[model samples]
Target: MVAQRVAVRPEEIRRHNLSRLLRSIHQHGELTRAELTATMGLNRSTIGALVSDLVALGLVTEYVPSGRDRAGRPSHVVAPRADGPYVLAVDLAVERIVTAAVGLGGTVHERRVTTIEGADRLPRAVVDQLAADAEWLAERLPGSQGPVGVGVSIPGTVRRRDGFVDHAPNLNWRAVPFGELLADRMPRRLDVQVGNDADLGAVAEHQRGAAVGCEHLIYLNGSVGVGGGIIADGGQLHGVGGYAGEIGHMTVNPDGPPCHCGSTGCIETYIGEHALLRAAGVTDQHGPQAIAAVFEAAAAGEQRAVDGVHTVAIWLGRSLANLVNCFNPQVIVVGGSLAEVVRLDRVSVETELDRRAMAAARAGVKVLLPGLDQDSALIGAAELAFGTLLASPDSMVASLTTT
Candidate 1:
């Protein structure tokens, strides 16, 4: 005999429907009540109730269209509330930290960037500085209510279970409980989520940047070092333990110069900022401005700069060839300093790809620059914070009420 079905609770159904409606509006920016009804395939009355609940919770706002002449009565548009809850997004790079306050509908309300110097390189010092920065940003928000949460993007591998930095060679951090450290330093109790910068970059690109609508994509980020993130079948590919996208460490030339990770001939050794600078016989520090100067020189026909970029392109192409054969992504986004180099010398990189990559693997694959550029990881961090609220609208409302 078949088992009896358990009765579904009406409250649970209401919560689920509310979440679905909010998610649709969050994803699509703004939708009229009638449009939401048509898109959600729900009855008009149900859509009205759900939107009303969302507005009551301060998650969305309904406004009549302005400056438009319509043939019939105008339907109200539902959009994320401008004065609603927001989250703090921190992007902790090797040499700098960027903090942003992001609200619903992907609006970045406030942002600050600070460069790290000598003693601040210590992990503890970095955490303290970022904590202070976050506190400052939190105070500037419109309301007194605390942020929904904090989402941090680090340039390293992070453990999924406990938010530890498994390895961050560029930052010289290893096996540090970075998430816990930051949480402890927070001015107030808040939920903190940590993720790899490259992984988050891929998330941003797939959702709102260059890779939008592309299910199979790869994102390669080059700063002081190289990092990678993969998206497969419309989801971020986090392998067991969340350490899958370490493409920078992939051995490209076993006999080449040693990498910061103690690996020889890694992809970063060939395409990273230091590698490019050394190849061009430049001794300036490896920063975004320095890298841009190199590219500008190449654009002006400087022989050393041109040669350095070409060498980088060849190695990068070889690395992309491997990724193409492995993942067969529809698009490959080259972000950060590498994007500048590629923008200046696309032909060299494409020629190498044509020669090295398998025809089947290279077919229909487009290599593009990041649409969001340096902001991709930061935007993704904001998305992470927004996702936490969207996942549990009822709990979020309760939390806000108590605050």
Candidate 2:
């Protein structure tokens, strides 16, 4: 006798389709079951069954109308439950530690910032302060759901694969297990993600700021030491070891000055805050004031001041031109505390790039200032936390069919 083949029920396929349909709806926000079915090309019964499962899982809620949908009772709409869970984002900068509680809706519920003068303070003190702030916020959440994850943005090269901080020169840290340390300290069970500050800033820009939809973008972070984040083809290109965007060390001048990285004349030798201060003869004062001093002196037509800005701009422009030739980016965004001082209104740098970069690469590439300024990294860190909860597999599976 020939082997008999078993027939598959239409309901089985419908159930599977229903699950996927609901996930799509949840991803885009509230939608009617009919809209879900139409979008997913599934039958009405499948959507209904899937929605029912979501409702039971407490992952979705129904929006009931008072009356009528074209000669019948109004159809109910479904939306992902807003009260599900939360994530905590910690932005660890050289001078500050900022903590924020974020949700699936990308809303920041609470935030706190603690300042530090130097790296001499205990690392445990910083962690304790951050944890305490998170506790204060957790008390204020509407429901019992705790934070699902924690994301930290550090101002240095972070090896995400092993969750280690290779170096944070600004903060004077080395080989620190930053993520694991925070995870062990927090009261709630949390999955931690550590990333470079500039990289996270680029992510925020891509998601909601200036770099939105651009295929090739470079975010050159002008800070204590210059670093950058690159995005190509709509995704952040974190190289093989997740350290691809370390553009600060790119040599701008081979024999100019010594850099902390033990290199002579790196781009940061000219573009870094220290270089600008020294060029302007205001190395005594630290932080944002030093940058302002350079601008003020330049505005006054002082030779040292004028020379400082011109030299920095020239080096910055040259480095940018080289990057343009290398990456062929659609846009380059300049961000940091100093980005606010000077407007890159006209490109003395673009002239350099025009001379160096390929015609096509130079044609439409825009190098502009970041809209968010220094806050970009903090905001990006919070976004990272917010996305962590929304992008979870459980959240996706729960959105469609609950069972």
- lDDT by candidate, in order shown: 0.86, 0.72
Query: How well does candidate 2 match the true structure, expressed as C-alpha RMSD?
Result: 5.6
Model 2 regions more than 4 Å off: 1-84, 120-122, 142-144, 292-307, 341-346, 386-388, 393-403
Best by TM-score: 1
Any runs in candidate 1 off by more than 4 Å, and if so which?
Answer: 1-6
Worst 10 residues of 1 by lDDT: 137-146
Best by lDDT: 1
Query: Tens digits of per-residue lDDT for model 2 on 1-76?
Result: 9989998798666455545654465345578777787887767886787778766655577887655445676668
Q: After superposition, how far is residue 246 of candidate 1 from its true place, in Å?
A: 0.4
Q: What CA RMSD would you report for each candidate? A: 1.7, 5.6
